[model samples]
Target chain A: MTTPPLPQWTALARDAVFTDPTEMLLKADRFDQTIRRRNWREYAAGVSGVLLSIGMAAFFAWVGDYAIVGAVMVTGMGFLVVMHNLRRHASPVERLPEEPCIEHLRRQYRYQAEALHSVASWYIGPLVPGFLAMQAAIFWNAAQDRGWEEALTDKGWPFALIVAFLIGVIALNRWAARDLRRKLAALETLD
Target chain B: MTQAAEALYRQAGAQFAPALARLARSVERDPEKARDLEQEMHCALWISLARFDGRCALKTWVYRVAHNVAADHVSRAVRGPQRVALDVIETLPSAGNVEAETAEALVLAQVGELIRRLPPVDMQVIVLWLEGESAADIADITGLSAGAVATRVHRIKALIAGHFQSEPAYGVTA
Candidate 1:
C-alpha cells in the first residue's frame, strides 16, 4: 500500500476549456425541446396503437367474426400491459444528481435485469393468449370450409411461426437478463 | 436553470473539466468518443444542476454527475469480458521498465489504457484518486465506504506506480 504522487494529469485541466456553461444551457434547452417533441410522438404512437386495436376489433365484430374480435381485444390488452410494464421498469436516461454512483448503477442494473427476467410475463405472456385464440379461430373457420386435416396443413404454419417467434423472443430476453444478472452479481461483490 | 445554478455550472466546468476529460479518456479509448463523453457529462451536469438542493458541495455534485455519466457510457459501450476486476488487474503485467526521460504524454496514454481495463467502480475510485481527490471525497462521490476507497486508492497507486520511473515506486515527475 504505497501513497505515490500521481502524474500531473490535472495540468491538462488548466489549459482545457471544455464547454461554456451558457452553451451547455442552450444545448440543454434544445435537448429538452427535442425530448418533449419525441415524447409527444411516442404518445401519439401509443394512441395510434390503441385506436388501431379498437378499430380492428370493431371491424371484425361488424364482419361477424367474433373470434377475430376477441383476439383483437386481447392483443390490445396485451399492448396496454406491455406499456405499463415499460413505464414501471424503464430507467430514465438522466440520473439524480445526489444519488451515489454505485447506487445509481445498481438501480439501473436491477431495472434492466428485472425487466428482462419478466419479459415473458409482461412482454410475451399477455400477447400469447391472443395469438393462440386468433390461430384457433382461424383454424376453426378453415376447418368449417375445408376438412380439419386440410385446414391444419394450410393454416398451421403461421401458428407454428408465431409460436416459434414468441419462443425466440423469450429466449433472447432471458439470455440478456442472465448477462445483466452476472454483471449485477459482480457489482454486488464491491459492497 | 437559475442564476445560481448557471454560476455553479460555470464554476464546476472551470474546476473539473480537465479531470472530467481525463476520466472520459480513461473510460473511452477513442479520442472522438472521449470528447463526446465529455460533452455528455457537461450536458448532464448542466441538466442536473437545475435541481441542486445545496445538500452537497458543488464539487461533489459535479464529479458525481460526471462519473455517473461516464460509468453509464462505459456500461453501454463496452460489454462484459473486456473489463477486468481489480484483483485481476493487480495480477496483470505492469508497463515494464521505462527510462527516466519517458515523455509524459506516452505515460499518460499508457495510464489511460490501463485504467480502461478496470471495472467501473475501481476505475472511478482510481481516477478520482489520480485527480487528487481525498479518499473521503471519493467515497462520497462514488458511494463506496471510506475504507473501501482507501483500500482501492492504495492498491491502485501501487499498480499505477509500476509504470513510471521512480525510486521506492511512484515518485516520478511529469
Candidate 2:
C-alpha cells in the first residue's frame, strides 16, 4: 500500500496518541522515580560492596585485632556515603534544553564523560587514606607477630602486587577518561 | 512535585502527549519498551519544566526533551554502539483531512516500515516534516540547519517517490 502524501501525516500521527499525562503529571514525583530507576543497579552494587566491606572490617577488628584499622574503614565508608548523598541532593541533573535534540544528546555525553573522568577523585580518592592506614596496620601487626625482616620478606611481594594493582586501576581510569574526552570532542564536532 | 513545576508539566503534557508517544514509537520497535520509554519521557518532561525558562517555543522544548530522552533510552536499552537513533514516521494530512489511521492505516503501516529503515537522523527529520512542522521548526528540534532540513526532506521525498512509482492514494505525487 502506498503511503499518503507528506502533508497528511500530521492527522494520522494522532492515531497513536498517548493519553493525557495528567495522572502521571499530578502524582508523578518523576525525578525521584527516574533517579531510583536509573541508579538502582548502581545502588545495588554499592550495597553489596558495603556489606562485603563490613564483613571484612569485622574480621579485621575481631580476628586480626585491628580495631583502629577496622574503625577507619567503616568510618570512611560512612563519610563517603554521607558526602555522596549530600552532593546528589544538592545539585540534580538539569533537563534537556529546547534548542535541538543533538545538543541535548551531546550534553548528556559530556556529563557522563566528565563523571568518568573524575571517578578517581569523587569515587576512589575518599577511600585512599583509610586504605593506606589499614595497610600500615596490617604491616605493623605482621611485623609484631613475626620479626620485621621476616614480615617484610613474607609480605613484600604481596604488598608490591597490591600497589601495582592500585596503580593499574588508576591508569585504567585515566585512560577511560581520555577516551571519553575524545568521544565528547567528536560529539561537539557534530554540532 | 513543586506546584509551579507540576503546573507547567501538566500543561505541556496535555499539549504534547501525542508528540511524546510518537517519539517513543519512533525510537523503539518493541511496544512494551515503547510504553516504558513514553512514560519515562513524560517524567523527564515533568522534571525538566523548571528549566524551560521561556528561551524557546513550548513545542521546541517539548520535542527536544522527548527526543533527548528517547535517544538516551535507545542507548541504555539497546546497549549497542550508538547507531543513528531513528524510527518509523507517519505522513501529513491531505487537503482532504485524512485521519491518521483511516483507510490509510495499511499505507501508513507500509510507510512506517520504510521510514523505520532510514537512519535515526533522517527518520526524525522526515517524521517532523511529515507532521507538518516548518523547515525552521524541524531544524530547531533536530539541531540541523535549515539547509540540512531541506536536504533531508529532499531525500525523504525521493525515498517516498521510489516506494510509490505509481500514484499514491493520499496525494504524495513525486
Over 4 Å off in model 1, which ranges?
A1-4, A50-65, A91-94, B78-81, B90-103, B164-174
In terms of lDDT, the poorest run of 10 residues in model 2 chain A is A1-10
- Per-residue error (Å), model 2, residue A151: 3.7
lDDT measured at residue A65 in model 1 versus the true structure, 0 to 100:
91
Each model's lDDT comes to 0.77, 0.64
Expressed as tens digits, the lDDT of each residue in A1-191 for candidate 2 is 12324544545446444434566655466556877875776666667767777777777667657655465675558555745743563353475445477676666667666665666666566666666676667677789899788888887888788778877787787787687577567545544
lDDT by residue (B72-101, candidate 2, tens digit) is 675466343234323223332121332445
Choose the strongest candidate by lDDT: 1
Q: What's candidate 2's DockQ score? A: 0.28
